[model samples]
Target: MYAIERFESRCKKAIESILKRSVELEVPPPEIGALFALPCHGLSKYPEELAGELASKLESLDIDLVGKIEARGAYVNFFPSGEFYEIVLREILQKGDDYGSGEKKDEVIVIDFSSPNVAKPMSVGHLRSTIIGQSLYNILTFLGYKCIGDNHLGDWGTQFGALLAAFELWGNEEELESDPIRHLFELYVKFHRESEKNERLEELAREKFRLLESGSEREKELWKRFVDLSLREFQRIYDLLGVKFDYVLGESFYYSRAKRLVQRALEQGIAKISKGVVVIPLEEFGLPPLVIQKSDETTLYSTRDLATIEYRLEEFSPSKMIYVVGAEQKLYFKQLFAAARKLGFNCNFVHVDFGLVTIGGEKMSTRRGKVVLLEDLLREAIAKAKQVIEERNPLLQNSDEIAKIVGIGAVIFNDLKGDRIQQVDFDLNRMLNFEGDSCPYVQYAYVRGRSILRTAGVTKVTLESVELLSDYEKKLIELLSFFPRIVKLAAETLKPHYIAQYLLDLAESFNSFYTHCRVIGSPNEATRLAIVSATTHVLKSGLSLLNIRAPEMM
Candidate 1:
């Protein structure tokens, strides 16, 4: 356990024990819940009388780890003694990269994210799901939960019928073989355009989809080709983004199961046909009716999603299944979860919805080709980073490699530096600003600390000669003590912003300490160097949790 957590736990126990021993005052224990951790800022929110009462109650008790507790006006503070600092610093230095990780957990969690439709380029819109899901995976895994990343690809449905129809009408084999996604996207756009004028195209598309669903050899082969080529394309982006999934189960993978499920639902009277389309009415649940199958018996995403839930339950029996999807589908997921509950699914379902990414206040659309391709955005960031690097450090070795790390890290940090539900206006300048609350700033802090340690020729750090500490050193240690708690909070809340904001605060704090405390030739050089080393480890570990690389140099 971390020093801060240990302190809080002991404080809670002490407070509870004190309440149990009280006779004259019938003080309820629930009122004292907020009084634990009595740190400098812990009791400021409580009433002065309550603070004093708690202080008087526990001032006599002998707590080993706690140093002193006192109430001042409406604010009460607890000062951790030298023993707490010793334990916190020693644990950080001893554990190194494993400082914040937890014990193993038996429960499994499946995260479904980054599920872009096949044959369409990944846009800025897909960035949130991909990175957010990856960060959650890292955090949950670090906290000892068995996490499964499932990239539930959108490879089946009526849209594919339109794509196939478009391809048969105007697609060139050579163009498709050369630039698969672009050509496929053009074909898709053309289909929507022509269908606006030619109603016959709609029937043609439905027929093509029916054929594909019914297992026509040629249709299946074409669809398989599309899926294969799309996967190769998606892998390139995933490689650049450092994203990997344990399962790449597409909608097609669950089609047969979905069909069987719909049949069972119909026979059991859980679903009914209206206007020749199968649906589960959720009006009683205060949601619109959920369509599981179209009029032509083509399975919809809802059908496949329910089938997916069933498959996960029977296969992994996960304790929780989280979907990292856009907020636009908020209602749809609620309906899906409600339908699943009605069908008696026992697992927990969570929709980790995020706001949309917009360019000039406009949501991206494939049909209009108004979206920025993720590859284009990433490559542009790299180029911008390279330009900045050359200007800053002309003779830096492996500048290209370093640029990739900084560029990609900046983009990711920009997305995660705020609340997940807040809309991000795609801005590369803000993301790449080295002095701002960007990833590069935090990365540079690590690089600066590493440089200090290298100059000191300190391959190993110890807290033995850490006597005569300054206020700055103590403040830095206090901030460092909160890292494990921050990690646990981020994991519990399913919010990476907690860690991001914490890292920013930590980096800022370290910078302040570095400015105030001299390390190279100071009397407390060993102590300050230990502080630098611990800060670098935490910065690196926290960045890894967000799936961003921390370069040794900037």
Candidate 2:
């Protein structure tokens, strides 16, 4: 158990014994300087009376972890013992990388994110879903939840028909071989532009899509090539981002199952036919009706999504299904979840909705060719990071590798540092600033801690020799002890930004300690060395939860 857990348990026991009743306690913030809260349901009218009674009872208890117990109104607050720092520090050093991790839960979780469309390059808009989903996966897995990341690829739809039509009209084998995604996107753009001038081209594209869906050999072959080429390009980006999906199930994977799902829904009366179209009427639930099939009897996105839910439940039996999507799709998920519940799915469903990522106050639009490619963004970030590395530490070896880590880490950190639902503007200048709440800043703190440990050259830490630690040391230890709690909160709230902010706080604490305290040749060198080592481990582990790398030298 963690030191805080032990403290909470002992405090609860003490309260229970004193009041002769079961009590639940909560840990307040550090600045509040209160460690526990006791409900005074029966004594609300006499809060001071309850406070006096509990204070007397707490004083009589034989608790060593708490040095002082005070009554504030109807609540009793417990303060940690002077020796708490020693206990927490020793535990941190002993646990090392596993200091803040929790025990495994006996449930599986499914996460759907980064579902880029086929024959299209990933744009900046996809970054939020990818990085946020990856971070949540990391945090939940760290907390011992069985996590399954599914890249629900958008490999089906009328868009593919447009691509096939354009390719048949003007595709070049050599151009496609040189750059598949770019060539395919150019063809897609051309199709839309021509269709704007020639309305018949739209019908032709729809015909091509219908043929593809009906499994025409020629259309199927073209569709397969588009999916294959798109996946290859996506794989390159995923590799750079260090993202891996357990299931890369695309919309086409559900094409066969969608008809069955619609039939089941119709049979179960979950869906109804109206005006030659099939939909689930959610008007009573104050939501738009969910369309399952078009007037032509062709399936829609909702149909595929419903099929996906059915398939996932049958395959994984997940305790929770989380969709990491933009907030604009709020109503879509609401209707989907409601339909699933109405269809008798007895499981948790959540939509982890995030705000938009804009550039210069304008939303990204791939159709208008006014968008930033994720690959281009990453390469530019790497290049800028290389410039910084050369200026700061030209003598550093493997500079390119370090630049990659720092550059990518900066982008990820900037994305995750804000609340998940808050809108974020992509500003390269601000994100790469090493002096702010960026990944580079926290990483540099980790490097500083490592440098201290290396310079100290201490192999062992003696607890007895570590007495009467300085104020900064105490603050650092206090912050370190809160790591497990922070991890738990992040997992419970499904907020990766909590971990990111916690890391920034821990980094700041360590920096203050480094600035104020000496470790290399001090009287408490061994003790300080132990603190430095523990801080380094924690920073690395915390950064890893956000799916950001912490370079030892940077």
For every candidate structure, what is the RMSD over all alpha carbons to the true structure, in angstroms?
A: 4.1, 2.5
Scored by CA lDDT, what does every candidate get? 0.86, 0.86
Model 2 has an lDDT value of 0.86
Which tens-of-lDDT digit does each residue in 1-554 have in candidate 1?
Answer: 77888777776677667555322211122223222333323333556776688787777776666677766655444566677777878889999988889999998999999999999999888999999999999999999999999999999998998988998989899998999999998889888888899999999999999999999998889889899999999999999899999999999999999999999999988889999999998988999889999988889989999999999999999999999998998999999999998777888999998989988888888887788899998998888988988898899889999999999998998999899989888776776676768888898899999999999999999888557777777778878888898899888888999999989988988999989998999988877888899999999999999999998876
Q: Score every model by TM-score.
A: 0.94, 0.93
Off by over 4 Å in 1: 20-46
Candidate 2 lDDT, tens digit per residue, 231-345? 9999999988888899898999998899888888899898999989998888778888888987766787888998899899999999999999999999889999988777777
TM-score, candidate number 1: 0.94
Top candidate (TM-score)? 1
- Scored against the true structure, residue 66 in model 2 reaches a CA lDDT of 82
